[model samples]
Target: MKSTTLSRALLASSIALALAGCNSSNSNDGGGHTLPLEECKTYQSAPEVIVLSDNENIERQTITIGATGDMHGRIFAYDYALDSVDVNAGFTKISTLLSEERAQNPNMIMIDLGDTLQGNSAELFNDLPVHPVVDTMNFMDYDLWVPGNHEFDFERSFLDKNIQAFEQAVISSNIVWDKNSDACATNGEEVPFLPSYQIFEIDGAKVAVVGLTPSWVTNWQASSPQNFRNLDFKNELESVRKAVEDATAKHQPDVVIGALHWGRKDGGTGVHKIATELADYFDVLFMGHEHAQFIERVEKDGDYTADQLNISVRDADGRPQNQVEDKNISERYHSANRHESVKVIEPGSWGWALAKAEIELYKDADGKWQIFDTTLANRTVADIEEDAALQQEMQEIHDASVIDANTQIGTVDGNFTFTGHVSKFGGDEAVHEDPQFDGATNRLYTTIHHAKVADMPLVDFINQTQIRVIEEKATDHNGNPVKVDVSAAALFGDSSNLTDGQVYLKKDSANLYMYDNMLVATEISGEQLQNFMEWSYSYFNTYQEGDITVSFNKDIRAYNYDLFDGQGFTYEVDIAQEPGNRVTITSIRGTEFDKDATYVIAVNDYRFSSTMVPNGWVSEEDELWNSADETVYAIRDMLTEYVAETGTLSAGEFTNQNWHIVQYGQTDAEGNLVGDKGALLKARETEEGSKLWQQLQNKEICVVREESRDSDITIAVNYKDGSTWYENPQPGTYQGCVH
Candidate 1:
């Protein structure tokens, strides 16, 4: 039965490949379009082929598999948003590598792990007859296509179009049609959104490829449920296991591969857990969605070890060896499994590298073809030149995207991002060079390190835009007009900043607000708001007695670190306090805060679904409004709309100066911050004897923490003119310093 279904598919594919070979004459460009052979002939480089296992058996057979994912629509080696030529990454470069590899070994299987249709300049061609990215993949002859979470970021029709346009098998076992819903009703028939898996006969041995998409798409795209429409993203582990078992029981594939559109440690359904739980079922797993690169081998008992071939190419026994870096590598496991280990490989995002797995097969005593050995490598495309033919074909699409991205939307007179020195001292002299800097009113920019450590104009701009959009269009649960008192938003891009007196283009807006999250207004008590702030501020590392520089917790993601701006409110985050005790609301609407008082707050729909509702901080039924209901659905669009309407961009219109972050070395009997790092902060109110603050703000002076002669903590200041000011201040024994 399995042979009857899959054999026909494979036969059709082979026939198509033969026709493509005949049509191209030189290369097998699977797409119907003729190849620009003469243009590409010069740029073609010889492929580097390395034997994974040392074998001389004549009966041994081999199959090379190539994989890519988290591409995010980087079709060409050009950044449309930045309007610059990115020489390092893009699918065009990967195409060159693919052509070279295919030339070396035509038995190769090409698979795209997904996240292929959203970023870079892919959205520009969404309404076209065929998406350029899909067209390029077709031209490259990709065999299996797996859908990633971001693939559903656009409209359902757009996603449907691309899926239909792909010439190969687009498989995902977990995404099934919601038969219970009217939109996807199949008259009580159970139906998967796409085929569960695809089997191919390579070198007379059956190879099965099963696809699994992340189940958490429901939470990420909660704001726009219509993107997925009637599709249900089922549990990853269950769906994938069923698909693998079914394929094995029927086809008995020589090698079972898991084309998982998920990261290695993405909560429960990560490839590490899947490899451990379903070790016997899978031979290799190709991963994506974290945009990271690594090749890890996991034991049947879940013992993990990573073999990074790019860092150091030495082979340990049969596995490559290297130390895992701080950037989320797998843990070392001393325990070993008696059975064969599962191999998992992931290529970094944006077409930086191609994840390759070479499997060697040999006949067993029973005359059945079995996997002899497997080796994985993430082949880099940084040195590989972009395929000339691919470039020529995509030149028009590239030019149009660049022109759209560079269209000037507005102008800014000053920098919206913090760029100066960030001192613990918030004194008057340390205030921003801008004449409008004010501390008590919260309309101020002191030192530069304000973004994650303290509130700044960059974050304020997003919060203000969200609040304005909600206040203008949102209504209460009963359809009455609503007023938004506070708004919270996270800084999505680290390099998101606007230059002074520069023409703000569409790209700049996209950089500032990177996601397509819709706005939502909700009602919560003062206590809940404080708790939310505390949770967000927990991203910071607690200040110790001797710590001079502020740092953040590496375990937390920057997107989860949110800041707030309100119509009338001021608060402080004390780094000296613990995570849960950091936030303190000083005033609300010029009055002292009451924990029991209720307030209306606006935030992105992602936060409303991923955090507030799930944490029981806010009820879903009491939700006030959703921006999706209005014409301006995305926050990114609302930002452009706000800027377009305002005509001019200025800090005065957005920055609320409602929040401050403080770290103190000593406190008085009444818990007041005394002379130390604390005194410099309080001196801002008086604006007198602020010479030291001025020096620190201008980068003429630097602060350093060291140990004193007596082993006490010493606060030292180095002046530009070769002067040293040191102080060893202890509780009630303050040693003042002089330069």
Candidate 2:
């Protein structure tokens, strides 16, 4: 079971490469070169073939199913630094584990659940003529594969080419070519992109493997609809039902297994609900998408009654009903039905683990194979030794990526550190004051303030790129070249904290990949613009008079924080105000605010697709431009080009301070301060006060302390409409300053 032994075992089998169809030419051909496109078009044209046979005389048979999903381009074992030790994970180790299992049972079948082509630096090889991951998968000899939603991240042509490179069967029951396209039709019916399912005859047992992908691919922000315009993603459950029925009628297999790219959560999709309702049809369900490891076993015996499973059932009104459980199968019964035993397993993402389902099948007197028992377990990569040969093979790809990542794109004059949030919270002082604030000091906060609350160099850089792109390609409704008046940007992911005065050489490109590569142009009214700012301000909790700290709402995600550039607008966020009323636009571009004016805005796809912001600020109808070129021009690339064009970059040239915060309260009838205004002001001067002051300085928040002898502790806040009073409040509760 050692990795060295596994490598030798794998090398001894010449059939691996031939079976995977990775060899360019036939094994008998001396060239051993990859076949040309004309000869390798086997995506859907190949029919199912029986590869193994089962002995009827044998009383029982066992099959091991090793499953992996969301590998995300991780080809080698990597050392992940945890709190105490380094944990290793990757396909290199997984290969050894799987090899040991296959050696024990030649009947073992390996499946990849999907989401394999995207996520890592190695994915850059996707555009290459021969993908490295394809080579690795062929080396590992995967039995079956399913396409995850991320597979559509690339154009149809690129995806199609990769599919043709796979030697094993690629199955997806729900994805089909456009029905109306006569070009892809066969006998007037739309042709499928891949086979729906494949029947594998392993030692005489006919096992049918069906694949299902998420239907929400069309709605994912990262996915471009135009890229998949030729395909349609059908409802998962309905597709599974149809595929199961078709496969059973055609093959009448001994067991049916599902390789689903959907996860357990609802997430605007009914994946979990559908999978539960149709549990009986699948002997084992291998799932992915959430990137979490889970194993569940559902069992039912002859003595078990349906009532036990229906106890928590709800009525149409969403209330618990006391009626007797119905035996007849209905949608409600289907929802509550767990009549048959089932087992579901999901391996964690990034090759951290593998899900193994071992099933024991018994041949009855009638010669029919039935599942006698089933067990599932998740094996972690941390527990296994890596395959040295596999690691050596992947090292070449990794070294190439490192070379590409370190290629000097441009240089910066000043340090562009990801300390925006930390600087706002007074850096180390904030963490020292309250340990709870430590979580906010991580990478998520580094660029939050720079991109969300205030104008910083990062947003300015992205905005400049967007503006340039929009000006070059965008047009108005009249077909006239349109100019973007304002640009919006957001920080998409975590990065290594960029140090001050550090030169951003080619080596720095890897850290900059988190921001999206494409830009989107859209139109927005002045009112919607204010609403967008208000949504950004909603990240903070209301500042009460007695509160010791100013903190962000725990419910808010750091990536959701966005800031606007291009327009010189000054706004104030009165934390004492209500959620939607927190942001007030005082002026725009040094002029009076006009609610009726419409402006062209450029933003990234992530911000453009966000629905968490209220008032429907970003709608598909308003989108005027999107980057859909065959060669992707991402924000990082733009930065590189900009830096190359202009020798040096400076934060001083890009940073803009147009917004601030005003913490005010109401005055009593006697014109005296009310509530805990005094106590809160005093707390702001304490060790906790460091973050408050830091935030005030970082946000340019103006605080006027008019020392008065008035006994009532209240603060007065002035508004464009009228003056209002704010009082002490608690967490999760807010009090509006009257307008």
Candidate 3:
């Protein structure tokens, strides 16, 4: 009953709702392989450093301990199907390591800190059994294990079942069980699981092992609230100190061992603080949480004052000193009072290794020595392997779910594995053969290029809504095909210095496909993406380049620089003989669009939620259409697909065209220079300044189709009519028109 409410204190109630209510009846005594777990409080001789009442004159002792973390169901059976996965391998590794150590001295005990469950691909399609993990742990002969935050990701009922399965002590110092509530309590009344701490003795040594877990586990784990109903995770170091104090005053234990799910030393603020601080109270800390290998003591060999006491234990936090702060272990040794300091150990996660400690008595009490009589014994490393018999027994249980590599969620055409950052958006030349660095050649370009590929794709959001354009699930694109969500940002800016007489590659004959555009390059995210968004509307001139007259409905955020005056674009009265396609403003949004009507955004869907465009956006009323989904293709994909099937791409060329740094105006039907045609032409011409111009003449290029078929097309031309030696009807000027 007490432990029930205590567990609730571990997390907020809202979180518990998602994880299922506390006290859900569920137990699987470890794959029907039940073992009688003994709770021992004594060893061969003497109470393992027995804690007596605080008579103000208690002898302090130094002890050794081992630790490991984040085994994550290595020994457990969350999913029983994969033949290659050694579910029970955790037991073999630890047991073997333990056997070898016991032959040497036998005071060492193995500790598992946290994350005993969740995070496996197979757990998705099967009813995960918590017992296999425990069975494996039991095989290793665990001294202590804590319920990690991941265990809470399951429902309260699952936690309950897992708790029942564990024959070992499952400590959660903060979680308090509620006795009054039948649901929270065990059966008719017996509450499930154990209290926070337990005392054990071995080799005539009395050690009190107290368990603790990170309080923040509630934030990430769903079942945290329900499983830990009414439980409270007190400040770790303080709680351990108090618990030790109480135990010493009552039972007089010699040493306090902390089996903490709480681990620090990572980038996180919470874990590191607890480990460094709580070190004072605990003689040995077997920690988990941030998965790291444990060392009885992390030594600084160079320049560090080994004997000097550090003002603060850790670099991250400066928590208030422990209640026994001022009480120095060294000073307490005068007369009957003995001296003792803390020893901490937190080992790595997973079933990778084992942490062990050996506590030895001081050689001479009267000798003046800054160093103690403790040292770290070598740790044990083991591989996760499969037990042949166990594997056979469980073979039928999971055979069907183990999917072949080829049959995994991929398209019939073949799995479209991501090549690199560059291939995703736009295009680059040459290195495309194998952008990934193959170790043989040590070229700096390949090394740097491959290094950038290590970045993972980020899941972006729009006003809290998941951008559904990115396909989250796997399915074949057949019959009426569904297009993958792919979008791009235009790089042209207001102050771009583009001009005419430029060249760009188009399909050689409008039939071949190509991705050889110079302006097109990936690294489309970060600064590049930001620059495009920031100056998105900067160069959008009307018929007149000098006209910098556009109304902003709201203050928009731009990425390149700040919202500068005139956006660095010095447009003048350079009027062209002909006009360019710039929309003439008549009336705008308020009266122009229907109040409740939806708008179709043709740009890389990101523009819908971004602030780059001054046009206030309306949500998609029904279904949004991207031409890639409607029998059309993005310029790059079309080329790739065309190449893949037809064995030939539409002919094209690569060239970096100039941009519109300044605007040029063109005369409209009113015979007046109404918009910036030169700036537009400048950008287009520069874009075509290379082999791209020749490719364009051969008529080979494809672009993302607008949502509407009638959307006016924007194309860049040579501005010079080609000299045709053939029929007069096939004019050379409009030959590369991208209609």
lDDT of each: 0.65, 0.57, 0.34
Backbone collisions counted per model = 2, 22, 107
**For model 1, how does the per-residue alpha-carbon lDDT over 1-739 read when each residue is reduced to its tens digit?**
0011112343344334322211111111123322222210111111111123333344667788899998887888776655666665688889888887888878688999999987774654554545668877877778779989888776566666667677778888888777777765577766777767888776467778899888888776766677777777888888988999888888888788889998766756677878888887787789888776666667675543342222224334332322121212332211122134566777777886888877777787766776655666777765578988878766656666666677677898655644334323222223333212111011122212335554557778888888777777877867888887788888765445665677877777776776767788989998898888889988766664333335456456567878888877778778778899988888876788888999888999889878887777888865788876565577877887777777788855665567666653233222233455553244432333255545454444443322111111133232222333323232111121111
In model 2, which regions exceed 4 Å deviation?
1-42, 45-53, 78-89, 185-188, 219-226, 297-341, 417-456, 472-481, 527-561, 570-588, 592-596, 606-621, 630-632, 659-739
RMSD (Cα, Å) for all candidates, in order, is 12.7, 12.7, 20.1
- Return the candidate ranking by lDDT, descending: 1, 2, 3
Which portions of model 3 miss their true places by more than 4 Å?
A: 1-65, 76-91, 121-130, 178-193, 222-232, 265-272, 275-280, 294-341, 362-372, 377-407, 412-739
Q: Give candidate 1 misplaced runs (Cα > 4 Å).
A: 1-58, 183-189, 303-339, 418-449, 664-739
On lDDT, the candidate that comes out on top is: 1
The best candidate in terms of TM-score: 1
lDDT of 2: 0.57
Decreasing TM-score order of the candidates: 1, 2, 3
